[model samples]
Target: MFAFFTRSIAAKLLVVTGVAIGLVLFLSNLVLISQTRDRVHALTMEQADAEAKSIAREVAGDIGELASAARTMAGVIGRGHEGQSFDRQGITNILKANLEQNPFAFGSWMAEEPGAIDGRKDDVKGQADLGANDDGIFTPYWSKDRNGAIQFSTFGAKYDAEWYALAAKSGKGAITAPYLAEGTDVPTTMSSIAYPVFSGGKMIGVSGVDISLLSLSDKLKALKPFETGRVLLVAQGQQWLVAPTDELLMKPYEEAGADALKTALSSGTGNLVPNLADANGEGFDRLLFPFAVPGVNTTWAVIIDIPHAAINAPVEAQTLMMIVGGLIVLGAVMMALFLAVRSIAQRPLHGLVGDVERMTKGDYASDVSNQDRQDEIGLVAKALDGFRHKLAESNMLAAEADAQRKAAEGERRRNEEERNQSASVQQHVVTALGSGLAQLSQGNLTYRIADEFPGE
Candidate 1:
C-alpha cells in the first residue's frame, strides 16, 4: 500500500483527500460534542434548581399549616367562648379537637400565666411532690401517644422558655427549629409554634402546637435529583433538617463541611457548591436552593447533592461513541474515494503508459487508444497517437531513400560492365589488326577468321 501510494497520482490524490476529509470530520465532531455537553450541563442545572424550589415550597407550606393552627387556637382562648370565661374543660375540648383536626401536628398546649386562666394558681400547688416542676402555672398539654391516643399533662412554668417568651414579647406566632422528640413510639423530628392570646387588649397566655417534621424527611428521601442525586433540608442556623444519612439529622451543617455552604446562607439565595466534603470527608457537588417556613423568621434551603461522576456520565459516554463513530465514518469514506480515484484515473493512465511503451518499440501499426475522450488521459493518448504518425512518416521516408540509392548503384554497375566490355573488344581488335598487318606479311587470312569474336 505504501509503495502504490508513493508511485501513483490516483493513490496520492486519495490520500490527500482522505486527510482533508478526516480533518473536517474531527473538527465538526469536536464542536458538536462540546456544545452538546454544555447544553446538557446547563439544562441539568436549571432543572435541579427548579426541583429544589418545588420541594422548598412544599416544606414551607407544611410548616405554615402548623403555625396557622396554633394562632387560631390562641385566638379562641383570648375571645373566651362568646365572652364567657375559658375554663379548664373548655381548654381540654379545644386542645383535643386541635390535635384531632390537624393530624400533621404532634401535640397542642396552652401555657397560662400564674393565676391567668380562671384565676387558678393553687391547683398546681400540691404538684411539687411529684417529679414535675412546681411553678404555679396552669399549662394544659394535649398530645397523641404512640397509638394516636390523646393524652393530657401539665407543662408547669415553661412560660419563660424561648418559644413562649418570643410569642409573649412579639405578640405573634412563629415556628421553632426541628428537634428529635423522644419518649414516643412515633419518634421523629418535631417543631413547635407559639402564639400569644390577648383578651380585652391585654396579654393573657400563650397557645402553641407541635408538628412532626418526619414528613419533610420522607418527602426529601422520596425525591430524587437527576435520578441518582440526593436531597437535604438545612435550616437557617445551619442545622440539618433532612439528610441522606440519619446521623446528620438535626445536626449542625458544620458536620457536612463548613466549606460546602460557606456564604450560601448569607447570600440567602440559590447557589452551587463544588467538591463539598462531608463528615466522612467524602466529596460531592451540591446545589443550594434557599427557602423558608412561613413566620419562622429564618432561611432554609433544599440541597441537592449530585456526585461528580453522575454529572459527567452522560457526556463521557457520548464522547466515546462519537470518537468511535467518527473513525468508522472516516474509514468508510476514504475507502470509497480510493476505489473511485483508481477507477476514474489510474486505470486509464496505465493504458496510456502502455501505448507510449509500444510506440518506443516502433510498433505504430496499431492505433493509439483513448484519443477521443476528453480528459488528461485522452490528451496524453492524442499526443501519443500524433507521435506514432510522425515516427511512421520518418521511417517511410528513410526506406524510400535507401531503395532509390540501391537502384542507382545497380544501374551504374550495369553501365560500367557494358563499357568495359566494349573497350576490351576494341583493344583486342587493334592488337589483332597490328598482328594481322604483321602476319599479312605472313598469314593474315587465318588470323582474321580465328579472331572473329562477339555478337552484341
Candidate 2:
C-alpha cells in the first residue's frame, strides 16, 4: 500500500486533497463551534432573563391586586370614620365582608387611635367589649381558620406589629416583611399591609389587610429554572417570602445558607449576580428583579437560580452533533476527490507507464498515448515519446554503418586475391626469365616475352 501510494500520482494527489479539505474543515468547524457555543450561551441567558421578567411581572400583578383590595377596605373605613364615631358593628361587618369577598385576603383589621372614637378614651380604656387596650386604643383583627371560618381577635399591644405604625407614619400604605402569623390554624407565612385613614386632617385610624405567602410560595416553588433550579421570592433583599423548601422560608439570605449573597443583596434592586455559591457551596447564577407590591409603595424581588451545567449540557450536545455532521461531509468530499483523481489522472498515468515499459523492452513502434493531454501526465508522455524517437534513429544509423563495413571488407578481399595472383605470375615469369637467361645468357629477352608478352 505504501509503495502504491508513493508511485501512484492519483493516490498522492487524492491524499493531499483529503488532507487539505480535512484541515480546512477542522479550522472552520473550530471557529463555528466557538461562535455557536457563545451564541447558545447568550441565547440561554436571554431566555433566563425573559423568564425572570415574566415571573416578576406576574408576581407584581398579584401584589397589585392585594394592594387594590386593601385600598378598597381603607376607603370604606375612611368614609365611615368621617362621621365622628366608630360604628362597632358596622366596622366589624365591613372587615368580615372584605375577607369573605376576596379569597386572597387572609385577614383584615382596623386599628384606631386613643380617644379617637366618640371622646371615650379613659372610660372604655382596657375594655374587652369595646376592643380597647390599656392605652384606650381599639384594634379589631378579623381572620380565617383552617376550615375557612371568620374568627374575631383583638390586637392588644400598641406596638405588637410594626406595620401599624409604619402605615400611620407613611400616611399612605405599608407592607410588612415575610413573617409567621401566629395563632392561625394553618400556621402559614404572610405579609401585612395597611393604609392610613384620615378624618378631618388628623390621623384617625389605620385599615389594613393580610396577604398569605402560601399560594405565592407554592406558585414560585413549582417554577424551576432550566428544570433544575428553584425560584425565590425575596422581600427587600432582607427576607425570604418564598423558598424552594419550607425550612428556608422567612429566613434571611445569610442564615439561609447564602452568606455569600451579601454583596448582591446590598447592591440593592435590579442587580443580577452570577457565579455565586449557595449555603451548600453549590454554584449558580441569581437574577434579582424587584417587582412592586400593589398597596405597599415598595418592591420585592424574585431570584431565579441557574446552574452552569444545565446551560452547557445542551450546547455541548449540539456541538457534538455539528462536528459529526461536518466530518461526514468531509468524508464525502474526500471520496469524490479520490474518484475524480482516479478518473482524470490515474488511468492516463497507467497508460503512459505501459508505453514506457514497452519502450524499455526496445519496442518503439507504438507512439506514447496522452502526449496531447495538457496535464503532467501528458508532459511525461511527450518527453518519453521524444526519447523513443531518438533511440529508434540511433538504432537505424547503427544498422546502416554495419552494412557499409561489410561491403568495404568484401572489396578489400577481392583486391587481395587479384594482387596475390599477379604476384605469383610475376614470380613465375621472373624464374622463367632467369632459367632462360642461364640457357641463353645470350637471348634472355625472348624468355621473358613468353611469360607476359602483351605489352612487349
Candidate 3:
C-alpha cells in the first residue's frame, strides 16, 4: 500500500490534502475548546455570585421581620402607650396581636427590671401568665402555635441566658447567633432579635422575637441551578447553618475545610470561587459565593457544587460537532480532488505510457489523438509522434539504398567475368598463329597447301 501510494499521483494528492485538513482542524479545535471553557467558567462564576446575593436578600428578609417586630414591641412597651401613660394590659394585648399577625415570627416577649413599671416583683418565676400573677419584674411572653392559637407566658426570672443578657448589657437592639430553638414542637435551628426596653431615661428590659432557620434551609435546598448543584449556607465561624445533610448541618465549619467557601466569606458580597472540588473528594466542580445580608452584622456564605461533567457538557458537544463537520468537509474536498486528478492528470499520463509502449515495438502507424489537446500532454504526444514518423521514413530510405547497392555489385561482377573470357580467347588465337609460323619456318609448305589454302 505504501509503495502504491508513493508511485500513484492520485493517492499522494489525497494524502496531502487529508494531512493539511487534519492539521488545520487540530489547531482550530484547540483554540475553540480553550475559549469555550473559559467563557463557560466565567459565566458560571457570575451565576454563582448572583445566586449568593439573592439568598442573602432572602435571609435578610427573614431576620429583618424579627428585628422589626422586636423594635416595634420595644418602642410600645418603653413609652407605655406612646409615652402617654403606663398600661401593662395594652402592652400584653399588642404582643398577642403581633404574634398572631406575623407568620415569620412564632413568639414575642417583654421582660423588664423589677419594679421598673408597676411596682411588680420578679418573685413569681416560671409562671404561665405574667399579667395575672404578682411579680416584682414585668415579664410577659406571647407565642402563636401552628394552629394560630396565641398563649401568654413568662420568661422565668433567671435572665442569665445570652439572648436576655446581651439585650440587657447592650443598650441597643441585637440579633443572636444561630442556635437550636429549644421547647419547639418540631426540632429546628433558630435565631432571635432582642431590643432593649427603656422609659424615663432608664433601661427597662428587653423585647424579643423568634425566627426559624428551617424555612431558609428549605429555600436553599429547593434551588435547581444545575443537575448536581448543591446549595448550603455557611457562617463566618465555618459552621453549617443550613446544609443538605443532617450530619454536616450545625457542624463546625472546619469539618468541611472548604477553602473556597472560606475565601468567599472573608471577601464579602459579590465574591466568587470557581472550580473547587467537593469536600468529600467526590471530584465534582464546586463554586463558592458569599454575601453580607442587609441589616445583619455578619458575613454569610453560600456554596454551590456543580458537577464537572455538567460544566463541560456544552464544550464537549461543540467539539464533537466541529470534528464531525471538519471530517465532512475534508471528505468532500478529497473526493472532488480525486475526480479532478483522474481527469486532468492520471488518464492523460496513462495514454502517454501506452503511446510510448507502442512506439518501442516499431508500430508507428496509429495517429496520436492527444497531439491536438492544447495542453502539456498534447505537446509531449506531438513530439513523440514526430520522432516515430521521422525514424520510420529514415528506415524505409535506408532499405531502398541497400537494395540498389547489391544490384550494382552483382552487375559489376558479371561484367568482370566476361572480360576475362574475352581476354583468354584472344590469347589462344595469338598462340595458335605463332605455332603456325614456326611450322612454316620448319618447311611445312606441304601441310599448308593441303589445308584448303588460305582464301583460295
TM per prediction: 0.79, 0.80, 0.78
Q: Give lDDT per model, in order.
A: 0.76, 0.77, 0.71
lDDT string, candidate 1, 217-277, tens digits: 7767887777667888887777788866888787888644455464676677677877766
Off by over 4 Å in 3: 81-89, 114-119, 131-160, 255-263, 266-275, 279-282, 365-456
Which should have the higher TM-score, number 1 or number 2? 2
Candidate 2: segments with Cα more than 4 A from true spot? 1-5, 84-86, 118-137, 147-150, 158-160, 255-269, 277-283, 402-456
* lDDT of candidate model 1 versus the reference: 0.76
lDDT of 2 at 12: 83
Candidate 2, pairs of clashing residues: 257-279
Model 3 scores worst on lDDT over the 10 consecutive residues at 447-456
**Per-residue C-alpha lDDT of model 2 across residues 234-298, encoded as one tens digit per residue:** 78746788875688788876543354344444554465577867668777777666666666877
True-structure lDDT of candidate 2: 0.77
Candidate 1, run of 10 with poorest lDDT: 124-133
TM-score-sorted candidate list, best first: 2, 1, 3
Q: Please, what are the lDDT tens digits per residue for candidate 3 over residues 1-456?
A: 999899998899889988998899889888988998889877766776677667667776766776777787788778783375756777777777778767777677777666666654555444445552344466676765556567666545447775677778867676666777554454567666788888877887777887666766777888876667778787766778787686767676663346656766777633444445666655555555666644435677776666676658878998899889988988898889899889988898888889778878877788665887888888988988898898788878988999999999999999999889778777766667777788889999654422222231
Best by lDDT: 2
What is candidate 1's TM-score against the reference? 0.79
